[model samples]
Target chain A: GAGVSQSPRYKVAKRGQDVALRCDPISGHVSLFWYQQALGQGPEFLTYFQNEAQLDKSGLPSDRFFAERPEGSVSTLKIQRTQQEDSAVYLCASKLKAPGQGRNEQYFGPGTRLTVT
Target chain B: AQSVSQHNHHVILSEAASLELGCNYSYGGTVNLFWYVQYPGQHLQLLLKYFSGDPLVKGIKGFEAEFIKSKFSFNLRKPSVQWSDTAEYFCAVIRRHSGGGADGLTFGKGTHLIIQP
Candidate 1:
C-alpha cells in the first residue's frame, strides 16, 4: 500500500461491548503508532511499536485498552467494555526508521471512527 | 510531560485572505515540530515539519511554519487561502532524544479553519 490503512472505517458498539480496530502500516515501516481523536480535539498518542516490540504503552488510557503488533506488519487495538467516552476516531500512523536519526515523518491512515452507544 | 496548545479553536476567512494559526509547546528541550491538515472526510496529511537548523520551514500547499525557540512556538502561515484550504489543523511535537521507545507525538487541540469563497 502507498499509505497506512485502517479497517472498519466506522464502528458502533453498545456500551460494554468489545471492539477491535485494525491497522496495516506502510510496507517496511519500522515504527507504528496509535492515537485516539475525540470530537473537536487533536489526536492523542495511545501507544508505539518498533517492529514487533511494544516499546511504549504508557499512553493507553486504561488496562482495558490494548494494542499489539505481533508480526510487525499489522496491528490491532482492542477495547474491552467500551464506554461512551471511548467514542472517537482511532488513528494509525507509520514511519521509516533512519539509523542515528532521532525522528522521521509519519504517514497517517484514514482512521476508524468508533461510536460506543 | 510535553503538551501543545493551539489558541484558535475556529477561524473564518474569505478567499485570498492572509492566514495564520498559532501553536505553542511546553517542552523545555530539543523537539521536532509538525503541522498536519485534515480535510473533511479525508485522512490527515502533513503540512510541514521542523527538525533542525533554519527556523522557517516550508510545506505542501504553500504553507510554512516558523519555529521560535524563545517562545516555544511553531506557528503556521500562508499569504493567501482558498476555500479548498478549509480544514482542521493540528500542531504536534516529539522530544528529540526520546529514542525508539517513545516516538509517538503529543498533539494540540486542533484549530478549525473555514475559508469562504
Candidate 2:
C-alpha cells in the first residue's frame, strides 16, 4: 500500500512569497497531521485534521500558517508569506483512526524541504 | 505544556553492541509514548508505542521500549544493534484526549545514532 506522501520534495521561496505544500494521506486514514523540523532538531507538531475538519491548529507557529483538507484525503498547508525562519522540512503523517480510538501509530511522508532566502 | 527530552543527542556504537537511548517527558496527566526512527533519506517510521497494558512493548527490528510512568520516561533499548540501525531516533508524547478533542505530538530533540560495522 502507498504510504503518506508529500508533494514538492524541495522548494526554494523568496522571503515574501507564498507557498503551499500538499500532502496525500493513506487511502483510508481519517486523521492527518503536519509537523515542522528545523535542522539539527526533531519535528514539532503543526496541525491536525480529522476527515475534513481542522481539529487542532495549536502547534502552528503563527497566523501565517494555514491548512485545509476539504476532501478529507488530500491536505494543503499554505504559508502566507515565507520567511527565513520558515526554512525547514515540513512533514505530514496519517493515522487510521481518530484520537482515543486505541491506535497510536502514524505513518509519515518523505517531507518537503522548504528554503526561504 | 508538555515537553520531551532525549538524553543523548548523538550515539555511536559498533555493530552487535548493546544500545540504550534514554528519553524523558514532563507531563503530569495521562499520555501516550512513542519511539520513531528516521533512516537517512527516508521518512520517519514508528518503532513502537506504549498506551497501556504492560510497560514493556516490543517493536519492529529488534527494538523495545519500556514506559516507566513513575520516572516519566520511555527508554528505547536493543540487545544488539546492526549497521543498518544507524538513524535518527525520536521520542514523542501526546496528552490523552479521551472524549473528543485532539492534540498534536510533542517530540524530543532526537538522537542521531551512528553504527560502526
Candidate 3:
C-alpha cells in the first residue's frame, strides 16, 4: 500500500463486547504506533512497536487493552470488555524507521472510528 | 509523564489574515516537535517538523513553526491563511533518541481553525 491503512472505518460494539482494529503500515517500515482520540481531543499514545518488539504499552488505559505486531508488518489493537468511554477514533501510524538518529516522519491512516454503545 | 497543551479550542479568522496557534509541551529532555493539519473529512497530515538546527522550520503550503526550547513551546504560523486552510491543527512532541521509543508522540488537544472568506 502507498500509505498506512486502517480497516473498518467505523465500528459499533455493544458494551462488554470485545473488538479488534487492524493496521497495515507502509511496506518495510520498522516502527508502528497506535493511538486513541476522544471527541475534540488529541490522539493519545497507546502503544509502540519496533519490528515485532512491543517496546512500549504504557498508554493502554487498562488491562483489557492489548496490542500486537507479531510479524512487525501488521498490527492489531484489541479491547476486551469494551466500555462506552472507550468510544473514540483509533489511529495507526508508521515511520520509515525508528525515530532516533534517523528521519522520523510518520504517515497516519484515516483512522478507525469506534463507538461502544 | 509528558503532555501537550493547545490553549485555543476554536479560532475564527478572515481569509488573508495572519495566523498563529500556540502549543506547549512538558518534557525535561530533548524533544522533536511537529505540527499536523486535518481538514474536514480528511486524515491528519504533517505541516512541518523541528528536530534540531535553526529554531525556525518551514513546511509545506507556506506554513512554518518556531521551536522555543526555553518555553517548551512550538508555535505554528502562516503569513496568510486561505479558506481552504480551515481545519484542525495538532502539535506533537517526541522524546529524544536517547529517551528511546521515538516513534511515539504526545499530542495536544488540537485547535480548530475556521478561515472565513
Which 10 consecutive residues of model 1 chain A have the lowest summed lDDT? A95-104
lDDT of 1 by residue, B9-116 (tens): 999999999999999999887778999999999999999999899999999999999999999999999999999999999999973335542478899999999999
Q: What shift in Å separates residue B46 of candidate 3 from its native position after superposition?
A: 0.6
Ranking by DockQ: 3, 2, 1
Name the 10 consecutive residues with the lowest summed lDDT in model 3 chain B.
B94-103
User: In model 1, which regions exceed 4 Å deviation?
Assistant: A98-103, B95-101
- State the weakest 10-residue window (summed lDDT) of model 2 chain B: B95-104
Which CAPRI tier for candidate 3?
A: high
lDDT of 2 at A28: 93
Candidate DockQ scores, in order: 0.71, 0.79, 0.84
Best by DockQ: 3
C-alpha lDDT of residue B57 in model 1: 98
Q: Rate the local accuracy (lDDT) of all candidates.
A: 0.92, 0.92, 0.91
* Tens-place lDDT digits, model 1, residues A1-117: 799999999999999999999999999999899999999999998988889998788889999999999999899999999999999999999989832356579899999999998
- The regions of model 2 sitting more than 4 angstroms off are B95-100
Off by over 4 Å in 3: B96-101
Error of 2 at B82 (Å): 1.0
